[model samples]
Target: MDSHPLKTLLHHHLASDASAVQHVPYTLASLTPAALLPSPHSSKWSARITSLLHAKTSDARWAGLCLAQKSALLSQPVMIESAQSWIAVALPLLAVRSLFLPRLNLMYLRTKRKESPPVLRAAIRLLRVIFTTATEMPEFQRQVATPNVAKFTVALISLVETCLDEELKILLLSTLTRIIPIYPTLHRPHQPALTALCFVYLNGNACKPPNAKLTTAASQLYAVLHLTGGKVGAANLWRKAVDDALDFGWTALSSIRTTFLADGRLPQVQSASEPITSVPLNLDRLRCCIVILGDLFSAPVHRLVQVPLGALVKFALALLTCSKEEKVETHLDPTTRMMESLATPRIWALSCDLITALANRQVFLGEAGPVHLTTLQSFGSHLTPSAPRIATCIAFQLEQELTPSERLPFLDALEALFSRCYTTHATLVVNRLAKTVLPCASSVLSQQEETPVVELESNGRSKKGKRVRDFEGDEVFKIRQVVCPTTVDGQIVLRAFAVLQLLLRNGGLSPALQSIVCRVCLSALLALAQMTPASLSPDVRLHALLSATIQKTCVEFASASVDGLSKSLGLIVSTCLAAGTLQHEIEYLLHPRLPPLLRTMPGIEALSLFRTEESEEESHLIKSFGLASVAPSAPPVVRAGSEPVTLLPKRQPTAPAAQPLAPAVEPPAALIFRPTPPAPKPPLKAPSPALKVGPAPAEAPTLPVPMDVEGDETNEDMPSIDLDSDSDSE
Candidate 1:
């Protein structure tokens, strides 16, 4: 067989030299496909690679790994052909399982030396490339990777456990992440060790100086393992993983709490016999716990797991309290500095995220199921005391220099906290929440207000005129303006209003605080009214919601007997009027619960006139305002030529004079009268001709009829007739 071109190069330059081995990968990468896969020499090249990988020296094995990585990167066909052989040869170099064994004898110790960093790195890189390349081809994976996946996974787990180099560990984690999904069942056996390793790195207990790249890789790998590594359903695995993370975090937190107490960071009740020893705070562990919790909370879980919200709330409150504690240290280590930098903001942000997640999941107040109710009870018990601290933390986070996107979570968290906690601790939550949120919301909204337009006059001389004069003789023009908030700012304002509404609706504010809230709401309403129609569609809804909120604020104030209720209501009415909104739009302001002073206001009266439907409440409102006369009434009847007819009262009847009693007569046996049969009617006479001749005579003068007087004796003397009498013959 012809000699291969790389044989001399590998044996001479790359066999014992590290620098030459570094260039081997580049040299191999630059070679053409024809050169890499020479038909007659392909078998010789494979044999050489296998021999080199199996060589005693680490340098030769390093060179072999480089060549394999390059071969795998070329194409699927080459990877399929060389993957099995490369894996077999490289697995021993990558595995650190033998390092844990005792030194049996001198010969065994000498033969079983751990691989050098370069060789192991090269091996990991080679495997990463192989998996990355093979992931694209089903044939390579099913044919080559299927048979060796179990051992391969075991080797990776060993390296992860025993590998000391952070870079190599990151590489190994990335490699595991890529292949865990493909052979999830194979990884099931090693899932526990893999999980522990991932947590080690994620919790930052592994290395002193925190490596962001390492932590990120471990986190991603951890997620992948739980999502795909288990034989159980993904949902079950996800829930269990979340629960495990929570438990792990709680343990770390307990340790942190103990340290805090020992160090006097937190107040503790100590006994006389107990010795006082200062323990250092494990900021690294705390940071790791926080990062893990943040990731778990931020990710979307498919199942509804009953999270221990009480514990989580306690954890968050502890962190917030710890963050505020003053730590006076003249000197700080790198790890401390790193933890301080990352953990502070992350602490606040994670608190916000946790609250937001709990709210979104509806763990506390979603349904009436047994699980939800239990969670609610536990959460309430924990939150009752810490509600103020939680609100303060949220407010403090909002005051930070956060982007609109970052501010959104804290805002949502604030709103959720207010909504859920306002029931038990309404006064405390409302006062704190309103003080912070209202100002922030107002400032953002005020920034978005349209800037005043500047008007300038041009003094250039007109073409037809000689003297310099004002252009168009002092005709000033103003530009029309619209108040359109950006997408993010608009959302912030909307949420702010929603929170304010919640606070106001809870009816727990002092009169002074209520006034401040009213002013804020009115200012927002004015701003919305000034918005142009061409503004975003969301603004329209915002305008409506703000109007209702203002009305609600007014009603709340009125019911609470707060001062300036009328002023608030009047301001709203005037704002509606100035905004050109129809009077009926704010008819809610005419609530019966409102003070009677609203009735005397012209705006209220005008709005009342526009009410198309008369509810009982409005009727009561009108009556309380003494506005019954102002209400619409029936029209009066009119006459054509004479004056309107006057209504006359009926006259009383006069009593008849007493007359002598009639004498009683003796009864006859047949006193009943019988009517005789009527005679036949006579034939009609022919007198019509004489009556017609006489009809030509002049008619007598018509006499005017006398009008009936109120007490007319002439009509009273007439006898009354009884129609029910049995005198038919007469």
Candidate 2:
């Protein structure tokens, strides 16, 4: 007795009097499967939708297509029940009538006139929904989709061939790609047609001008066809595509080379015998070929095949080498000259893309051994001349706000370039490495101190029987910061540091250049150590690494130039002392490496004194003095022989020539300081009772044992005093 809800909503929304259909989608979306197809009215709902789809008017068909798509999305059961009727009517809407007049030899195909855009778009969406819904349920696919695969394939291909609208064609291609994977064999019969259609747009020889969006979609479809079409001949298919593209690209490149030289000058002598049917240089065609190569290389299947790295590298090099010498003249043909002017840069960009694809693939496969080394060698050879230009580009990109995905690859590329080429181009590479590393490291160090404020509610009552106050607090209420460099900032900083270390170890810069580099490295590392979070677990390890690097740098510089080493050591000690951080780091550096150097060098004694004093202070603080307290001892000063010299407590003037004096007690071994081993002192004879009633020879004033100005290792094995002890005994 009641009109169907589907019909009622459709009539209300699609009425001829309705001025705007803007609200129709939302109004229709509100209808649920239960409301449209109640148990009692399910059959009637299907009947109503079928009748509407078969209606003559465009509005009726649009409403029906919209309902079909929504229904397919809402309830898979409803789709299964009425899919036949939906497909039956939707396929007819794509057909265009062609009228032929034999006498005049004219044919008229009315695509737009027959099917309006609204109806066509809706039909495509509805079909996509149907295929997608079928894919989710195996039962539905087996019973409903498997039987109709051929029919659907034929209809979609027919529309693709005759469709005049670009948007519609793209939609058709996308849908075909989606459905092909559902039942790859079902679409096998029509694979050739689909492949050809995709290539039409891919090759940029379509009936209309090339559309980037369309070409991208076509490339995606092409890859899917080969990837999922069948695995039997997939590799061969990829190989053939790559080979054909390379052949065509090389031909086009040769033609361009003949026209323009590397420096943009015309060649003095041209080849006498030109190839028959020389392909003219088409920039679009060239770009398409490069894009294809990029896509093929980027695919996961690339790992299974042997990529032509040599050919790819050579091609990229040739493209990068070809540069325009001067601007185009006004008298030349506008199209030809514009292509020539724009061609080089665009080709260069595409070539770079190809190179990136290869690099990323190599990295992804984890082939970083001999194979990767060979690849890097190839890139380095080609990239040596353009190192500055490439470095500039890399630096400029790094300065931008890039996501981790983008930043990481550029970093990897930069590292690869520097590692292979720094031997010959140390200055250029080292300078760029510094420029890239310092800023990123500084940024990470800055973030370590940023403790954001957080607020918390207290559960316990105050002592006054009032609710605890609410306030913002720093660090106490904030979550504990991560210890490792897990964040993006930390990752960038870590990567930059790695690159810096790599260059420092292998770059082999001259003394002057190395000093500059060592200075930069020390500054960055000190900042990292000083600002490193207290709670971070890597603190000890980071400090150790920093010390090791500094030690190695110092040793290297000392071997080459002592003055530079002194300056670097001075900078390091001064920075550590000033910041009051990296105390352990400085100790590690100074303990073994510092004593071997000349102590007369400025700041060397001060550094030694500072270390000794700090150690004494720490010992005093840690060691407890019992009730029988003792005076704090002075720090033992480090002398030239890498051993500390301490002055023993002066004894009271004994018994002024008194009659009997107790036997003199010898000083403890640790308290004794022997300069030059005391020349194997003669064994002393026992003193006779008659010996010495007069005053004992006044003990020669112990010269403050002359400090070892040149730290010598000969006395390194001598027994040294323990300044940390308070006891006078050994």
Candidate 3:
């Protein structure tokens, strides 16, 4: 920490003399080329530099400038030090830099005006020289090791964090990127710094027209460390970074609005601090988000789960929304919203990846808890609005036919998206799936079926009978047409089937909802099933595998049902065959596909789908199809004090009232009212009304009364008696 005599002397003399400052460069220039870094004077020069490098000095505050200048001057352009001379100075300089370089920019930035700080600029150059002289050259490369790398990475990371000059940050990061790979094993000591550094660069901006050197540095450094021994640490760091970025994305994008400049460009409006940068910082942020996710996704399943995927899903949407092109009063199309960042095909691709990643990350796939609910709402907002475009991008990319490794992740993502998203989001996904399958479906639907027919005629060959008509038959064969889907199309459709199945199971659908979804899924399912390969091809094999996977999921991972899915598959064939693309299915096929469950009750039709009786439109779609009929309107409401109501059927006037056969036994039942029956003189000829299912109500009992088990009212009690002495005559 103490100042060296030479350093103190140089500082003091340079202020007063001014001649000493001029004398040094001249003195160095006047020296013999070998003496400057001359072979003859190499040993003595190396010795002096070694002493100067080791000397305690007041250089701590100005280390970046002093060391950078010294490093530049020592590694002269006119005469290179023999590889031998590098031995003494190279190790010490590297050692000193690691110790001193971490905060090179902070002090420099404070004193700097608009221009880049001299110290940091010199320092970046110094690092480049050290890296080239040491790691890049084969002769001195042995000096690169973990301890040195740790120091270098830490220093560079600190500079990157504090350096205001984007140029310097880029320089520092790029240098570290090269050095870190030389000794990837040593970065643990500098993990935190590396993580922060990666975050900055992965989301950093460009210098001119736009580039991603920092992003590349970030990517390289991460790859060297993480892909080797630091998988666990890397995954943790990535997860944390993703969560943080996702939070920032949510906050940043939720508030990010768009407006049109006078020139017709959609300018992004964010908080005052988030100044717009030409490098597309939003794109960088999205790139960072996707990189972390893309890497994590490639990690083991357990490691992948470490990510808070729900946030990633929201973050992806947030990225798109934030980057969306805002068309104002201009001739440009309003729908063309892919910005510089999003317009790059990768952004759209990443968006789908994150969506798919989110889908794959089902801790509780169908859980209806608070977290799931939030995820559902967020996913709906992000996906429903842009699913068509996202799908288009994905389809286009797939059309490029990337390598299996490259393409499978996308397919996995699509499968995950279809399996995981639900409700309206699920509807959007189903629509995408339908679009994916429609081409194949249309091709298959055009094929025709042939049936074999046979005719039997009486053959006149009299082998054994009188009128032996032998069977003369024209044999025909029946060709049951199969859907004939392509291998890729079949696999994609099969996956689509899984998605539909997941929607029903994951949504915890009610019978009505399940029925509605079944119908919707069934329409697409039928279209897809039409291409269902009868023979076992790759697509057919995948179908069988998918069926088993789904069955297994139902058995273990999820509470879904293979049988239910099979049933859905069957219904898809039947209903779709019956009502080709059920009216409501088309609702989901359009841009911004909305789930039928969102605005309407589960019903037979969507377009002609009628609201309940609450509406005054007086519509009846169910009745129109003759599937059901309308009932007569209800009678008007009766007042509380209105006349007594009766529910009894009207009596026939042609028949006289019947007398009870047990009239003699019933006369003693009510002695107090016996006088009413005394004057009856005519004999009753009519029979009683036929006994109904329940006991007939007594004629004398009031209609509103509650039935008592002990009422003891007999059939003979209230009978119309025969008054012509018919009982006595009998």
Residue-level lDDT of model 2, residues 187-221, one tens digit each, is 77777877788777766442345578777777766
Which candidate ranks first by lDDT, i.e. highest?
1
> Under the 3 Å rule for N, CA and C atoms, how many clashes does model 1 have?
0
Worst 10 residues of 2 by lDDT: 622-631
Task: List CA RMSD, all candidates.
Answer: 27.2, 20.6, 27.4
Model 1 segments more than 4 A misplaced: 1-57, 97-113, 131-143, 198-212, 216-221, 224-234, 254-282, 294-393, 396-730
- Order of candidate numbers by lDDT, starting with the best: 1, 2, 3
lDDT per residue for candidate 1 within 1-730, as digits (tens), equals 8555566445554454464567775667555565666455566656767777887778877887777777667654666777888877776665554444232111221235578888888887877667656566677777766766666666777667777788878888888887886677767767777888787776544224677788778877776665453444654675566667667655554443332332454433332221111112344555555556545543333334445556777767655544423454444334433444444554555556566544443333335432332222323333445567777767666655767766666777777766665344447656666666665456423323232222212222223434332367343463333333556655676677777766665546544454445545555566555654345333556556555555554444433332434545666566656645536545544544456444222222222223234456555543443334322332222121222222222121222222322222112221112111222443212233212112111432211122232222233332333444679977
The C-alpha stretches of model 2 lying farther than 4 A from their native spots are 1-23, 28-48, 98-113, 136-139, 205-210, 261-281, 298-303, 326-342, 361-730
In model 1, which range of ten residues has the least summed lDDT? 271-280
Candidate 3 ranges beyond 4 A from true positions: 1-240, 247-285, 294-313, 319-327, 330-349, 359-488, 506-730
Write down the lDDT of every candidate, Cα atoms only: 0.54, 0.53, 0.41
TM-score (all chains, Cα) for each model: 0.43, 0.48, 0.32
**Which candidate gets the maximum TM-score versus the true structure?**
2
| Cα lDDT over the full model 2 | 0.53
TM-score-based ranking, best first? 2, 1, 3
Candidate 3, 686-709: lDDT as tens digits: 334432123234743221112211
Model 2 earns a TM-score of 0.48
